[model samples]
Target: MSMFLVRSFDDPKGYIELNRPDGTLPRTSSESYVPWGVSTHGKIVYAKTGEHTGWRGGTGQHRLRPYDTTVSQNRRRQCQSELGVMILNNPSFTAKAVSKVSNAMRLYLQSQDAATAMACIYKQIGHYFYTGGRFGFGRISESKKDDIGVDGVWRGIMQALLLGRLDQKMSIHDAIGRKVLPVLKGGQLVKYTNLATVVRQDWFDDPTRRGRVNAPVRAPVTTKGGISKLDTPAGGTVAQGRNRGVDMFSRDLHRTRDKDADAYYDDADARNLLFGAGISGTTGTLLQAGIAFGKLTAAEDLKQYTLAIIGYLVGGGMHSYHETMAVASKVGVPYNPGAFETSMPESFRRSGLYTAWRANFYDIVVLGATHWRNNSGYLPSHLNKELTSPA
Candidate 1:
């Protein structure tokens, strides 16, 4: 006789199968086998080969038998329930709203010649500098003539364009790093049900994922005394503990403080410092050259307006290209302007129109409030004083 034992961790009493030497036997309770002494949380199967009356009186050596096992239905149900909850709480909806707003703001600003408006604002602030002739080492000496001349126009145009570019860069960075990338990564997490799977898929889809997967790989800057100079990722170890995508959003929004200097700098401030200097220097040099060679002339009202429009386009285009290239490089994707065509038809939809209208309305309200504030009190008076002050 031969006996086999079938055991499962979830069951305390295991079943047994008995067979005769001819491999045939009538199934009966007395012929069943029982485990003598074994305890485990995993499945185990044992078999005895020889004549046997029962498990307690078996006269043969016992050996393990193999069998297949399946995942419990309860576990699968739990996974499905978790997935449903995650889907319900997905952040993509909010991200899409933010994206629409950002795009709309970009369109509205472009429509209104933001660069020129920015230049006019700067002029109001810088009237004192313009009045002070030969005030600095810069070659554009203040003119004795009261009217804005070629040099002044070119300076204003360049400075305004620089500011506009800085603003556009900051907006794009915030929208992408804070909103777009996080939503995308979160969607992948929900789909894959694992971080490693999502990371691998991203790597496969775009090799540049290694560079821009929102993983905090960079070591934080530290002072000579080993104090951290800025806010770093929350993980005690690099790139392992925290959710990289969420941490990235936090880092982007984190404001850094200069303890020694008693100064505060946020992401916007840092970006401005990095991009503003380069844009201003490059554009200023170009404008100065144009003025020196008589390529640029004094602004008539129409010409001033035309120059502002041109400045807006040039400044906006350069910044857009820069942002596109940066993202492409980080994500291992080709920069393709043609991809925008896919969404062109949707731009005419009612929702799109509403978003556009809402964005423009926001801009108008902001501009009107700024105008009111500037015209109301100390600002206008101070500007007037600066304008009237002698060189």
Candidate 2:
């Protein structure tokens, strides 16, 4: 059957030119003037390389062709409207969307000193893209078990809630709007769309630039007094009284993979760091393991994140080596040599195994707070809900 996407096509001669503005067109004698050298002679026909060279923009791939006028125009309009829709529907549209959620999470944290706004925002981003403002995770195409409790875009809601509730308001908007708009609009609130437009036009070419929302990693506490109850202890390590629970939890997560001490810990340091002392208990181990494994089973979240990034394409959610590390951080787990690098066998990375593992992980521990909130509410029921609802 023919797809509805066909309606979005516009001009047949307006093929997407992939070259830089000033770049030369391939087959046009490399002199740089034949920018539109590659043209589609007929509707739906692929562009053929002509004698004149057409240079590509930016990457210089030189794959320019004339798009079908009708198809190109329709697609262009649809894209613009869709982009606007995306901006308007973004979760962080208003202050309360961020503030209410962030505040909810702040109650559990001890201190907000040096808290990062970006980290909080990022946690929610995965949710935003995955849910696509629809709420439910829907049918996950792939499976992973390491994604914690989040299956879609709302995954980052926890971080946002935690950070937003802190003393400082964590805004994911531009500085200019932050300064001028408050007064410009006579104290009326601005939206993510407003801020994103500025960001898209100026500061960053890619809205989803990593480190754009820089989340600072807290320094590890060394002194005994500074340890949290979350930490579990180990033997033979002079760093006694260290609460290594989080670390220990990460190490012994996959019990089936390693019922033995050596299997539980990937390295001697991790094992020695958590062995012995009154700290290790069966109950504690079970509870901690449950939580850790919960984070590891992110199959659904992996599927959702992958789908979101692919569907959005141009939004700031592009894949990065750092995202895996970010997820590890959220779970309070440490990343090893294999998380970001292509070290894992292609079979492991590409196969549905990782995603399946992550999905289960998300289902157990982290609650899909944002997904539930947005989807189950009166959101889809009322257009005026945006006015009545906090977000």
Candidate 3:
């Protein structure tokens, strides 16, 4: 019925005047205050009119009501959650429960995901060559074959493993956008739309702010290549959530609609360096695309490679556009084009491309590795033993 989230909400609080809710508090623009307009009432969220409050924290149409800690205390006293108390008290029991679930999952993944050759892309041409046939994939949810997210999340996992990335993790909390899906309830088909995509990220407000993390468009090959900041602001772009520049991942899955990517990128430098855009800001994404294409397919022949490259470009490009637009449209600044191509860091976790790419990468890791002794090699597993078989 209900689920509890694991991340803290980091959005700016609105300047709430006990009675006056005109989206503004009594404060002059001349006053030096925190990015969150700190007045007698509360946070300086956003003034649509821009007449009284000049600063715009985000693009949310409605302001969040200031939470009262007293309510939580009162609720705790009145009715305590039994499950929460048990989970907190019994650490061993919780660990055992998690292990049981994980063990079952390991079997399922090995049998179906890793060994099974009947995946989305592989189903058609799996048993053909050595490479394509070796790729692994799995599906989640009650999605059909054509769903964008079928191999999406798995792709991200593979990519994370390939890149060995472990920083600035973002957990999907809730989305402010909308997503429509067809579901059959009582054997009847119906449309399902979500209200908001809530997320729990490491740092929503200026992840690299306070002179801590230095986010560039394309990080140098070496430890110290040059000084660069986020060419784009930390607000709008699909990959803006990442400050690591390229070779990273967003790891968020905010299902959004098409109407979200029709605005300009946030131009504020408050979060970026005061000098200018990053080094790779001017560089086009075509090169990046080519690099990725080479790594994935590694086309041996010229003509086939060209044709395959074209197909992948056309398909992958569209997916990237759709996802980036949805992300940019929901939270900050106006819709800016090429958000998937642009922005800081890599938004793989929340990206459809990351899903596909990561899955392929992990296939190489798990199936191709010499750890399992299949008369060959790779991750050792005895779970594949069949009850009855003929030699």
Candidate 4:
């Protein structure tokens, strides 16, 4: 007898297909049978048929297959979530991005001629002060319109000047050079190494080129016992010779390991200055607009103050973290948060929570004020009447 197996779509049951009563198998074409199935709980069961060869000769084979689309989709989502978490937690992502930006900035700086770059920098600095003065005075003028007089104007001018001078003194370039570049370049390891190289080069370079001639040889003094000996002990004592050798070795090692430190610092500083100036210019413009239109209530003002503090903390923390990483990488030292905290400057270390807060807070305030001013404008009287009567 010939037989075939059949299975239900929704349940596990088997049915047997037997041969005809005349003891002959029925001939079945490939497309004679249609398979149907339904999806249960996002799982689909379908019948598949193929030819199978056995002792009874070749026969048609059918099987029910199950697949869950929802499970596959969920797995895909989980994989994406894990990827996002990995990217977020990876320090190299931030470091590489920041490095790329810094490199691009450096290339731009290099492309500009020295005269042009300096001119642009100076022009930007002037604009920063000018806009800053306007914003500072404008805020005061708006708040004390009734009380503002000649003396008030003078006071505003004086205050603006003072503020501008302060801003210039605490220049953004200073922050980039003293904080950003050092961290980005991996700290004093690079700086000291470069300095040592320069020192070694100078020590080895011939002084005759600069118009300094070698000292004349002194005559050897003859001892009373007829022992002739040159003064200064023929290149000084063994200890002095050893010290010189040690110094040269140290310098050579430094140069070999950190050859481009000084050059990197200079490039990094220039790039940072250019970038910082652009940011400052944008900030000044926003602050000027805010001073022109935004009204500050006590609550709103307090919120801004809080936001500014938060911004500073975030900015400073990022800077510190990157710097710590750079330093650790350069020195072959294991990274530790406590080490970074200890290495920070006294002012920054003491005000650990407030290190980058000032810059961040200022940015937030200007941006928030600009947003409020733009959105909280007075509605036209005509529009209000139209809305009330018709809509």
Candidate that scores best on TM-score: 3
The per-prediction CA RMSD against the true structure, in angstroms, equals: 28.3, 26.0, 25.0, 34.3
**After superposing candidate 4, which stretches have Cα over 4 Å from the reference?**
1-124, 128-169, 172-320, 323-339, 347-391
Put down candidate 4 lDDT per residue, 1-391, tens digits, no spaces. Answer: 3222322333333223333343222335652221122133222222233422111211233232322232222222222222222222222322222223233334433455655543443333333323332322112233333244333433343344233222221223222223333333323225433433222322123222111122233222121110011222211111000111101111111121122333322232222211010001112221211221122223333223212211221121111122222222232222232112222223232342333322222111111111121122323323322222211
Q: Which runs in model 2 stand beyond 4 Å of their true positions? A: 3-296, 306-313, 317-391
lDDT for each residue of candidate 3 in 66-152, tens digit (9 for 90 to 100): 212222122111111111122222223222222222232233233443423124223332121112222111111223333433354
Candidate 1, residues 1-391: lDDT per residue as tens digits? 3333433333334435433453222335544322222224322233222222123222224332222111111111122222212212222222332233334323323444456533432343233333345321111225532466534544543443233232222223232222223333323223223322211222222322111233255432221110111242211111111111112212222112222111111221221111110111122222222222222333222122112211221222221111222222222222222111111112222244323322322211111111121121222222223222212
Q: Please estimate how well model 2 matches the true structure, expressed as its whole-model Cα lDDT.
A: 0.25
Q: Cα miss at 232, model 1 (Å)?
A: 28
lDDT of 4 at 170: 20
Ranking by TM-score: 3, 2, 4, 1
TM-score of 2: 0.18
Each candidate structure's TM-score, on Cα atoms with residue i matched to residue i, is 0.16, 0.18, 0.19, 0.17
lDDT for each of the candidates? 0.25, 0.25, 0.22, 0.25
Clashing residue pairs in candidate 4 (N, C-alpha, C atoms within 3 angstroms) = 308-361, 312-356, 312-357
Show where candidate 1 strays beyond 4 Å.
1-279, 295-297, 300-317, 320-391
In angstroms, the error of model 1 at 211 is 21
How many clashes does each candidate structure show, in the order listed? 1, 98, 27, 3
